[model samples]
Target: MSDSSFLNWPFFEERHRVLAAALEGWCASHLPVDHSDVDAACKGLVAALGAAGFLQPSGAGAGEKLDVRSLCLIRETLARHDALADFSFAMQGLGMGAVSLFGTEEQRLWLEKTRAGKAIAAFALTEPGSGSDVANTATLAEKVEGGYRLSGEKTYISNGGIADVYVIFARTGEAPGARGLSAFLMPADVAGLTIAERIEVIAPHPLARLKLEGVFLPESALIGKAGEGFKLAMSVLDVFRSTVGAAALGMARRALDEALARVQARKIQGEPLANLQMVQGHLADMALKVDAAALLVYRAAWTKDQGAARVSREAAMAKLYATEAAQEVIDAALQLHGGDGVRHGMKVEELYRDIRALRIYEGASDVQRVVIARTILGEAR
Candidate 1:
């Protein structure tokens, strides 16, 4: 059901081909874990991914940088097999991305554990009020006697309740709006930190709302420099946002595969459903979407890997197109399945749930349009 032809595109290297094949084989045996207990399933997937060495690319080693193409490939494959598996693998990179990109030598110790799948990691940037308006983040990190006292709320945080560490963003008041924000590495057990609510989404990801009365962190807990949180967050998103598209691509590909299979297997009026002209057209459109999405997703990733300072515009385009395209592709597949598409225990049903959040998270589709518009307008000026 998976398409391997895309791996031959110029955007990928020989190493990427090898990595995709190897990970695909691994996922065939390990994915689609029991999700009845979402948190436990995520923890198990993370540990399994870590032990298998598939998670090594999630974080960079000393003097090493993250390979975006590899990250995208791993995510695509995992998502194709299991959305939960993809989620587990992705959070490791996203949760610790700030540290991997800008943390001091001492702070990277957490990277070792996260890369090894020994600990869970979370990225806490979304607040109840801010949503995509990151500049409006109201969390405060006041300088105390020895360290900073963080007091704010973070909602819709991934890997929230079970995370061992979090890359949390808060306002340090160094300036105003986005400039005043800073990133910190706050351990989950820190005093004054509370999981106020466990948020259940259409997809069963481990999400939570957190309240911090006065979570204290030593000077060492800061990631990068003060007032650099917004920069750090954007940098991390620039890297991971494309991978989100890759994940969506994976799901879309699965949808196409499922649609093809269903069409050929099911019969209508004493003939295979696939024999119908309309079905063929639908299949053609689905295939077209998947391929176009693949092109954009890898283009952004390849551009970033080539050492462009920031692929913000490319990343946003890739993310927006791929996710939106995936949703369309998946819905077409589900429609092709007739009633079975929505039936319990169906893969397409699960994918239908999984592909939705991709559009909303990281950066919403509307936000991507704004970013693209601003970049082009700024360049025009």
Candidate 2:
């Protein structure tokens, strides 16, 4: 099995190993359909995941919860089986992570409800003009008599149209950058909050552009201190970005497995493809990349679990290497499959689309490079 060696890695403990096995077992029996209905598929996956109790690791209870190592392991395994499954699981944790990490008592309650699959959650930070530049956000929130009135648009939001609650970042002060921003927990029922457009991508999911037109939020909606939204967003990303790499690692592993199975069973030049030196070389490369990606991903996750408040450099490295590596691995797998790889609804074909979004979201590969460089320079100074 592709997972045989992954369990022996030092980054994982007995619990992680057990969780991986259990999730794999569950997925074998309960995996969702491989159809094209992205939104319906995601909702079904979410409900199934929640019901199966797989969402717990991502949505642990308040105080001393959510084993990061286990979360990564689950993502890696699910991603190997189904990319949409990974998305359904990862977003549950990330969409509500800020509340888990920095929210008030009320927010904690909201998180608990969402974690239980009673509601959907979302994180809204990206605007049309501000993909990687948080400081340049045009979203504005003006303090009203008893609350704040928010006005702006956020694009590329996962679970946007369906989320029951959103952690939204907006400029609260007239100051020019990230320092002027703040975060608020806005309910989907809030006045003037609308889904402007549903976005379609290479691998469609429930993504949308959110428009807030003078939406008034109670003072209690604020999360963390005023002017700390950027920091909060970054902190949440630091914790979750490595998991993205873990998901990519999962995809790469599955792709490698698919290639291996196909090559061993199919004949090319008067023999099994696996007997060819070129095929062997490609398999070796895929194996090496999958192992290396797993190590980087788990290392970052382990660092965060070991009480590091920030894992900027490590997370960036993990995300950058694992995601890019997964792309290469998936491409090689596709090559090994030849025409079958590109066949509609094929596992490798779906993975090809699934892996593309990882590079663009959380932070783009180029943005991650900038982050790593800046962190290195700062440490040196």
Candidate 3:
């Protein structure tokens, strides 16, 4: 079993431990769902997670803020059992994060069905021309007679095709660059919004390219305010970025577990592989990566829960280190598994594919390095 000792760490509280235990139990019974049909699997997982109340923490009621520690712990645990489960749960929070953090009472009402898993949510910020350049967002949201008309294409949107609602960032021309963006809560059924294409990745989830051609929304659909989309999107990322690291930590832990078992079971030179010093060294390195990643992940989460306003530096560090470390740990685990590691059904093989996208999404490792550097430089100024 993966180490439960991390729960005893001072970074967590009694209630956090309770949540971890309860989620672990629930995952043991319900996870590793069929993936033959990835879309169907995600839909079912969301509903099951909602019915089980595990998804409650993804959203907050009025006057409540998201508990960062809880989000991280749940994601870590879910990822350990099934990466898809983690995706399903994480998207619910990220997809609707803007609503939870900045929406009006009327806008946030959608949280009811979202948190209940009856409705799916999506965040649409990345566009065809801009990936990390939030300021370069080209999607235009033109003020209309009664509402706004959005015209742009968004690619690599999570839950893009399946989501019931999307929080789209578009240029409102309030000012130049980042300052001119605005956010809107657009329903997927809007007349002008269409799924341009479905993207297939090494590890499958419901990802899509979306085309919005004059999609119209009433003024009430505005999230926070016009010209605040950049700030709002950053704020939402501030909360969810650390959780990405938590998911990586979970995958690393699973890789370590699989490695430990492989080392003990496989024999070499007529002795168990665990007896070999070289093999033990690999095992040690894997364990070290997992622990180090966990520490950074939880530290970021705990710092956010302490109400730091923005944990960008900490979250960037956590996301960069944990994801890179998990990639190494999973690679080592696969190497130890010998040729079986490359086989289609092996857990390590699945983890290998699963961990790659973590390093790229949320924020690429190199982008995180830039974030950390910029934060330190700005502080010095």
Local accuracy by lDDT, each model = 0.95, 0.88, 0.93
Model 1 gets an lDDT of 0.95
Model 1, C-alpha of 171: deviation from truth (Å): 0.6
TM-scores vs. true structure, each candidate: 0.99, 0.97, 0.99
lDDT digits (tens) for residues 1-381 of candidate 1: 587998899999899999998898898888789999999999999999999999999999779989999999999999999999999999999999999999999989999999999999999999999999999999999999888999989999999999999999999999989999999999999999999999999999999999999899998999999999999999999999999999999999999999999999999999999999999999999999999999999999999999999999999999999999999999999999999999988999999999999999999999999999999999999
Clashing pairs in 3: none
Candidate with top lDDT is 1
The model with the greater lDDT, 1 or 3, is 1
In Å, residue 76's CA in model 3 sits off its true spot by 0.4
Residue pairs clashing, model 1 = none
Candidate 3, 47: how far from true, in Å? 0.3
Q: Which whole-number lDDT from 0 to 100 does residue 160 have in model 1?
A: 92
Judged by lDDT relative to the true structure, which candidate is superior, 1 or 2? 1
What lDDT score is found at residue 329 in candidate 3?
95
